[model samples]
Target: MQHQPDFSPAADRNKQPILDMLLRVLAPQGSALEIASGTGQHAAWFAAGLPGWAWQPTEVQPEALASILAWTRSQGLANVRPPMLLDVASPDSWPADAQFDLVYCANLIHIAPWPVCAALMRASARLLAARGKLITYGPYLESDIATSEGNIAFDASLKQRNPAWGLRALDEVAQEAASAGLRLAGRHALPANNLLLVWERAEH
Candidate 1:
């Protein structure tokens, strides 16, 4: 059998931590829509663990989506649906009929431009039911402290790779979520200087 290389070593290392957070925040039974489901590793792991919930992994990049589907098929995980083509920046491009109890995105905000993050918040707000959750994981700058030197170096590298890409400020993200009618529920520090940000739709 030909070996297929897993594209994301970081995803492999962080899957367990991300899963732990999801298990705590996600509803007992409902659908979860994962945005930018790169490599499909997290989706496969989460779907297998939470068999009661449907996992829909989506990616905007064609190559990434193809990899996701291939990985899902290889794992033979029944709960994980085939990857959908989704662009966070395109609100209308989202599946209109699908409603999710949780909208999860990992390691995407900083890699994408600011407009994409804004669009993600708006789209997530629209997709989630009242009181539903939106979970995001990645590196961010907190208000009280200077960004860690490692994170600063990482940000510089990201910017060098793409001017639009870099670490985001937690406070700004929280404010944007609030503007979208979502309230910050909690922030959990994770390995490798990443953070798991949980937000819930605010009561009208």
Candidate 2:
């Protein structure tokens, strides 16, 4: 039997919207490192959309590499590199001597242990170029904004599945980035009540 790529309905639906935001925020040309490239849907979509960007997709699950490759290969996107094995929780799992203009991660922090969030910030800090940005997209809890009922329920269900997994507050996420010498540079509200946040080097 041939290997089949995993698909996410949500990713399929939201890829265009997310690409629209990326078009608005990203530079004309640069390198991008995508963390937790789940299902490889986003990697293919974004790589096709941002033709000038060289996209490197990484995932902790070795099994996921095939799916990522399948998707990107099907798209015939030369800009999308082969998927790499990466675990945000492991400091040594990141690519050595690599610096990307953008580190993009979507919908992973809320489903993983809290430590992964901190580790992501630290690793991103080390991998981003001086003027690079870390862009994260997902539903997040905010102290100032009223939480959507759907997000609240989603958060509850996540905690039910794993006590360590739940929606993280935006402020708390910012603090972790700050600890890693990054700062919240931009925040954009996207469809489905999700937020796309941009973090850049603190000194830059």
Candidate 3:
């Protein structure tokens, strides 16, 4: 049988790091909602490796959604659900019956507008169970630390492509999460100047 091509070279490079983070942070067994599941490569690999979690991968773009579904079907990953059409900016776009133990989003912040990031936090806060985790991976600007020159250039290029597309300040994101009843749990520095930010829903 011919295999569906994996569309994301970046996903191939970052999947292991993402898996390592998920292994440490996510609950042993529950549903994990993945936002912007580009190409579904990461979803398939993660669902296959972490059999305990039911992975629901979603995408906003139709083409990407089709690719995600193709990958999910090709892998025969029973734990991974069909790709959902989700726009992070629209709260109603989220599934009404879905409540996740963990919410994972990768490489979205720098590429999307700032309001999308805010919406993501709010949506995750609403969808996550109490004390459930939300994890995001991407480049960010830290208050005290200078970004690597490569990342700086990359940020500029992203903004040039779309004025709203640029790296977000870590402190700003934390504040948004806080406003949405989520608190930053930790930030892990990954290879390639990326970061994995872990947040948890605030306890009542």
Candidate 4:
């Protein structure tokens, strides 16, 4: 056997930093829904780090399911649940039985089409507990900040691959989040010129 375990180099590099930030931002014990769990790496690592939190790792692509299940089982992570088939573009497919305190997704905004972002934001609002939060990590373009050469190149490459895919504007994303009833909570800079955006739904 190849022993591949479905790897993503970017995930390996950013997982620790992301976890470090989550430790400070997220509450001690809560339920988490991880969108677009590509290889299950983050789910495995984060679940291990926050043992008190229950994690539900979901992916839309069927091809990614095996690896996610394999990784979760292999790690014997009690806090992580089995993988769920979730497509941000398909709200009907989203699980209705459960809501979460923390909804986390990484590298999704630019890779997926624009509609997916709207769908995700809207659903996240409906799926959150009263004080739940949505956290997204990815490279973005901010009008005020000078765009890094590497990020610009990456954005160009992404658009070349899929005309609809590229780095999103921070203000545009923030506006979309607002329309979905989420407010900008905070934003953190990560390594590799990426960003971690936090949106919160406070109790009324």
**Which one is best on lDDT?**
2
lDDT per residue as tens, model 2, 1-204: 446899999999889999999999999899999999989999999999999999999999999999999999998899999999999999888998999999999999999999899999999999999999999999999999999999999999999999999999999999999999999999999999999999999998
lDDT of 1 by residue, 1-204 (tens): 533635789999999988888788776789899999988888888888788899999998877876787777777888888888999988777989778888999999999998887888989998897767899999999889778889999999999999999999988998899898888888999998899998888774
The positional error of residue 135 in candidate 2, measured at the CA in angstroms, is 0.4
Total residue pair clashes for candidate 4: 0
* Per-prediction TM-score: 0.94, 0.98, 0.95, 0.96
For model 3, the local distance difference test gives 0.89
* Candidate 2 ranges with C-alpha deviation above 4 Å: none
Clashing pairs in 1: none
lDDT of each: 0.87, 0.96, 0.89, 0.91
Which pairs, if any, clash in model 4? none
Model 1 bad stretches (over 4 Å):
1-5
Candidate 1 scores a C-alpha RMSD against the true structure in Å of 1.7
Pick the winner on lDDT between candidates 2 and 3. 2
> Residues 1-204, candidate 3, lDDT per residue (tens digit)?
544654888899999988988888776889999999988999988998898999999999877877787777877888999889999988888988778998999999889999998899988998898778899999999999999998999999999999999999999999998899888888899889999999987674
Q: Whose TM-score is higher: candidate 3's or candidate 4's?
A: 4
| Strongest candidate by TM-score | 2
